[model samples]
Target: MRRLAVLLLTAFTAALTLTSTAGAHWHPKPTTAAWQWQLQGKIDLAIEADVYEVDGFEVPAKTVSALHRKGRRAICYLDVGSWESYRPDADRFPESVLGRAYAGYPDERWLDIRRIDILAPILRSRFDRCRRKGFDAIEPDNIAGYENKTGFPLTAPDQLRFNRWVAREVHRRGMAVALKNDPEQVGQLVGRFDFAIVEECFAYEECGKFSPFVGAGKAVFVAEYSEPLAAICDQAERLRFSVIHKDYDLFARPWEPCFP
Candidate 1:
């Protein structure tokens, strides 16, 4: 009985140590407010960019290392709401989880985020991949699909539950996560997400919606694809947004920065 008790105590100690080590290695804070979200390819070392937003799946670990060497943080961009058939792990997702095709993007389909039991593991694995690749944070795109015709009857509540879960999972993995353009829930989710990465918020007149995030002392990164620079720059500055004018494709293009 004495020997058994000692063994149990040793096991408990080992478990506690493992948990502490995992916690320490996983949680990385966002280094800066300014960042680039380029998913076109690998890190363009010649571009002299501060942050390289690369495809979470395609980008290799070496590229992340190179960016770190330059004292730059790398953000891994992954599609959490929509399913792209081209990804290597595409086969892992079952057909039932796939709903209608996303409007304008033929290759992508909306995911049934209601099925968290099925989808959470997949997303967690994706986050794990980003963590393994040395990514400091994650930018999960298409998070606002519930606002569009996703074919599934996704309510605001459904979106809220899914978005909150995504944030929690990323945090659990010790990675900072960004809320990507779910303007309606900004007030509620601002505290949950580390930052806000909004696309064309100026054009949509929804920049005001995400003020909560900025008020919470979190960074709001805005990218305007179609809005006139002169018109949006003033509002962007007033809102304290790190705004940039970029093309729709989001490649390494000449961007008009609203802030110095």
Candidate 2:
């Protein structure tokens, strides 16, 4: 019995070691990568993009497989901070945890991320679904609920704790994760996340805030709705940001790349 116990202990130690070193495996963050962000309608794979960020549950597995076949990477788009009523798992979120409706998105409500104990499992299932769909990474959306009228008195520390946990969970599932729209915590989160997705950072003149991510040699993907490709391409190129000029609808056509 003593010998068997020793063997089990050794195995446990090795397992723990593996877990510690799991996400340390360096993934070369793309240099001005060509990326496409499309969330609605059938994902048209014909676009000239190296990375495709699409809806996790809506995108078909075969589409991911096809992207893989074409030597493209896929990032699963999952909403971690806000709960969407239209999602299949919408019923899983209790009414108590649901906060005010997401600004501009009436169907979506902000989630009280302080309740990570309840949120983590649901998020894990979503990550697993992404894994099964062959996603190479994750773009967890709306994680910066602390900056919004989330109906919960969420603090910056709370957001940081939740964002770090989210990144670790994604790493645990053997996938890279992005810091989405949480520019305020970039210095704290740049090391934790593999990359970042910023919406209208240039328009808001907040593009400079992501310097930590760029400084850490991680990719910073920028998307602008109204800016023409010419207005931003030169600046994006100088900053080493992979940018795109797309409409609010995020349709297949007119995915204008601004990578320099």
Candidate 3:
């Protein structure tokens, strides 16, 4: 009886530790969140923001550590729905899963999200890299490929399945994941993703579609390339979104935040 009691106590302790660790993942709230997104040029750590979203591969682990040292959360950016020819793992992607070139970006091709078996391993390896680099979260870009001209006959359901898998994988790594620019799936994915990172929603007047995240108290980070702050700032403030006016290249400068 004494030995059995000791084993039970050990199991219970292990369960508690696992639960606490899982619950420790960062979930940024809209009220207190401010963010910077710079995927080009040297990362400007001098930017005053609570969060910095930078390229997972280009930015070193030391940069992530530096953000943490400044009491800021770091979000790792990686293309999940598209394949870039420039990436180090470019050869790992099988040709069978490659589709039409991403419009405007000739070097990037849309990935067949339906082929999860082939993609899962590659993405898992990338996610593992992000986790090992000490990033607090992930910004999986190009997630709404179904709505695009991707050669695959991908339906809404296919995108949902793929996006959910992304969130689950990121969560398993004990990091937050963003739902990038999939306004149509916002209702279904808001609960699954920790936050929403969108581009040009104001330009398209589709900003309202992301209200579900804000309504759920999750941060909604918006990056507008052309629209001036005067044109969207009022509505952005009302929606409680963290809006930024950035250059198309997404360099560290030309950084304009609505709340800042």
| lDDT values, one for every candidate | 0.80, 0.87, 0.92
TM-score ranking from best candidate downward: 2, 3, 1
The number of clashing residue pairs in model 2 is 0
TM-score to true structure, per model: 0.88, 0.93, 0.92
Which 10 consecutive residues of model 3 have the lowest summed lDDT? 27-36
Root-mean-square deviation of every model: 3.0, 2.2, 2.8
Candidate 2 Cα outliers beyond 4 Å, as residue runs: 2-21, 24-30
lDDT of predicted model 3: 0.92
Candidate 1, residues 202-242, lDDT tens digits: the string is 88889889888777777778888889878877677678787
Q: lDDT at 10 for candidate 1?
A: 100
Which segments of model 3 are wrong by more than 4 Å?
1-19
Give the TM-score (vs. native) of candidate 1. Answer: 0.88
Q: After superposition, how far is residue 129 of candidate 3 from its true place, in Å?
A: 0.6
Task: Please give, for residues 1-260, the per-residue lDDT of candidate 3 as tens digits.
Answer: 99999999999998788667657899988842457999999989999888899999999999999999999999999999999999999999999999999989999999999999999999999999999999999999999998999999999999999999999889878899999998988999999999999999999999999999988989999999989889888888889999988899889988888876
- Which candidate model has the greater lDDT, 1 or 2? 2
- Residue pairs clashing in model 3 are none
